[model samples]
Target: MSIKITKMIAKTHCYIGQNHPNYVIIHETDNWAKGANSRAHATAMKNGNLDGTVHYYVDSQECYQTLEHQDGAWAVGDGKGKYGITNKNSINIEICVNPESNYYVAVDRAAQLAAMLLNQYGWDTSHLKRHYDASRKHCPRRILDEGLWDNFVKCTKSYMKKGTNAGSVKPVKEEEPAKLYRVRKTWADSKSQIGAYAYLDNAKIACPAGYSVYDWTGKNVYTNTTAKTGTQATKLKGLTPADLIKKIGPLFTADQLKTGVLASVSMAQFILESGWGKSGLTQKANNAFGMKQNLSGNTWPGSKWDGKSVVSMRTGEQKKNGEHYTITANFRRYPCIEDSIGDHSAYLAGAKNGNALRYAGLKGCKDYKKAATIIKNGGYATDINYVNQLCRIIEQYKLTDYDVKAGNTGTDSKPAATTPTSTTTQKKTFKVKVTANDLRIRKGPGTDYAFTGKYTGKGRFTIVEEKGGWGRLKSGAGWICLTVNCVTRV
Candidate 1:
């Protein structure tokens, strides 16, 4: 017997194509009709005012036909085309029930109906989909959230695997596996340190000369629960610090304070390095970490407590290279959090020293590891362990949470701590091409002077004048081109 379907024709145009592959989309009526049949919807479709109809309907008891399989239907809208799917190549099936009914049966029957359709086209269960999948609508909301779709896929795959369709599943091509990379320590051989720990779970393994290892996800070499491996230790979503308020509370800006992790890291590291901001350098000079001094200038700005002598960096030459030891007197003590974060980022970024090396490839360094390494190897910090400690702190205390945007509000509008360029709003001017390259013009009507644009040798002005450069005089005004003008000593 041939399958029969009762369909509702909406006043909308049917969108279907013949060449496209057939896709079965299932939906729920979400009606309150008793016994799983929605008479109201059927009536609405017959009035010519109806919107659309599905190919078939399955209730708790029996199946009802709405439309013929071969006939075009208007259930799925044209918007599905946005997802590269067209209704012409698809079948829409609806299942009606009380929103509070046992939804599992609907999902099960939907899968069965889908299988029936799949058999017609010699297609596998993969061709079946949900209305939500067709477009971004939240229709059949309950079925999707209950994981019915995943369950349906599993059942379909299982049934297909047992039959002639077993070999029909897309074949998995065998290829070379990806190469495993090992992380290396920048100064693993240095004499100033005790050996670092190897894999947390694999006590039997030791780090090789150039490689350092960590297993945050416990992918391998982990047996004991005590080991800090896998996503557990590295996942810094939720961590509680004992001395959060006491150590780093006062130092955090409004933005930093908003992020719990960044705030915690700042507190923990500061306490570990400066002893609660009470260390000799911190108490007297406000140098929280006893960061080495390197400069000649005497005036920067700092409160003198106990006469401990403060140092500030001089703005003579930017981008210092290589490693220089001892305090050269160039360290500055920032009075606020805004300056500290900016300076810290710049100092490690090399961009801080006006050296582009640190900023070269650091933009997408999401995790702290890459950012720290780039800073360390890029020669931003003299300390070899700088990157490691920074990365570790960021990991340990989840410092990213406390990441505050570097800026200020209200009375304390000190220019940001990083480069002065960041605070300055430079005018954006597009290059306007002139008829001639390197063309020069006069600054005044008396042939006094001047120059616009790029200097490619032959002739052109490095600067362009708007009005007074060449006013009214004679012989086409006093505007003398740079090529025609003679240089006069000012």
Candidate 2:
């Protein structure tokens, strides 16, 4: 079918050209129903609705176009301009899948199209992104939840790189369906349980003991085995956790990898709070740690989880004289997992919490658990057992292994406070004329800050410190930095 183009599509500028590094971003129409296509076309160019358009749409068998290949589509925002590509550099590729649909034919088509785009642009599979990558909205929820996304990307990248292997693309195996299994909890297998579960299919069909027969959604998706097996792990060969590790682990930093610190907090915290970075918070918000703070009027805009439901202050009671913290339903979000971890570290660095103990240089403390307790008892959280839970998670998963191996291992430990330098011995300071029309007095002992009214260069102040052509002056707001010629102390 010929794809219809809106008038807005015609007027849109082609921001990106062949010269730009091309990227294909995947999205979902997010609207279900057979007539969704017609609705999309009619509403696309509506005056009130933003004049946005994607390159292609795949729905089961057909492809629709709201804009031509050359037109710029305002799809993703972040990482776009920063990467030297504008909105025009991205192609909005959408899949039309009804949320209620049983089979995801559109997903399959999207994967193929994504592969085609990668090959056509000579871009790697890493260029592929979900719509949510750029914004805080869920576009392709169905396919992502099904766990087919990883496989789809893997297949697409492989196909684009060397063309598909004839046997590799065979219709998904049916007769000898792979069975799903649940891990029976044991101390020995608990450390890497998530990894073990994720890679079960690739572990050679043998049951990992106590993991009874399950289908792809496992007991959660189906009522019984009599029904069709969902995404049988046993069907695909060459499936392994290493594949997932390669896809996910490398995206993290050395500090994150070695310290079991996924984002911030211990990796176990991410596993518990974000389900191993599978929760919408980590996937969408990049917020792996559920740290909450009300900024301006906006709450951290993403998703949240603290393993089970987090117990927060629900209501604040106005006692006749004071307010009491009451339990509430609130959680924190981050822009990305990286942001979440960075915020987590920043919080520990800033807040007086038990996490501070985890710092290796913390005087007297040796590890996270001990540090956690110290922080907890020192009133990190109001919760009586907050430290215990954090300690439990750390010990349960041996998360300290990662933190201990981090390059900044000893850095977190508290440093010896420096004794204030005596300003007794000093040199005669000279003053210089300000030649520039609009000169600035830096804040530190350098020429880096914009001068406030406090330093006018006319006032004679003592040169308390000097370094790199800048001098420190004692102003009303403590010591401030000024250029060498700005002031002098005789």
For model 1, residues 103-208, the per-residue Cα lDDT tens digits are: 4444544555566567667887668777766675544544542223444555444434433211122211224221111122323323211112211311212232
Model 2 weakest 10-residue run by lDDT? 228-237
lDDT of 2 by residue, 208-246 (tens): 223332334434221112332212211211222223222
Provide TM-scores for the models.
0.32, 0.36
Q: Which TM-score value belongs to model 1?
A: 0.32
Best by TM-score: 2
Name model 1 segments beyond 4 Å from true.
1-21, 32-49, 159-490
Deviation in Å, model 1, residue 242 alpha carbon: 21
Candidate 2, RMSD to the unseen true structure: 22.7
As a whole number from 0 to 100, the lDDT of residue 147 in candidate 1 is 28
- Candidate 1 local lDDT, residue 414: 25
| Candidate of highest lDDT | 2
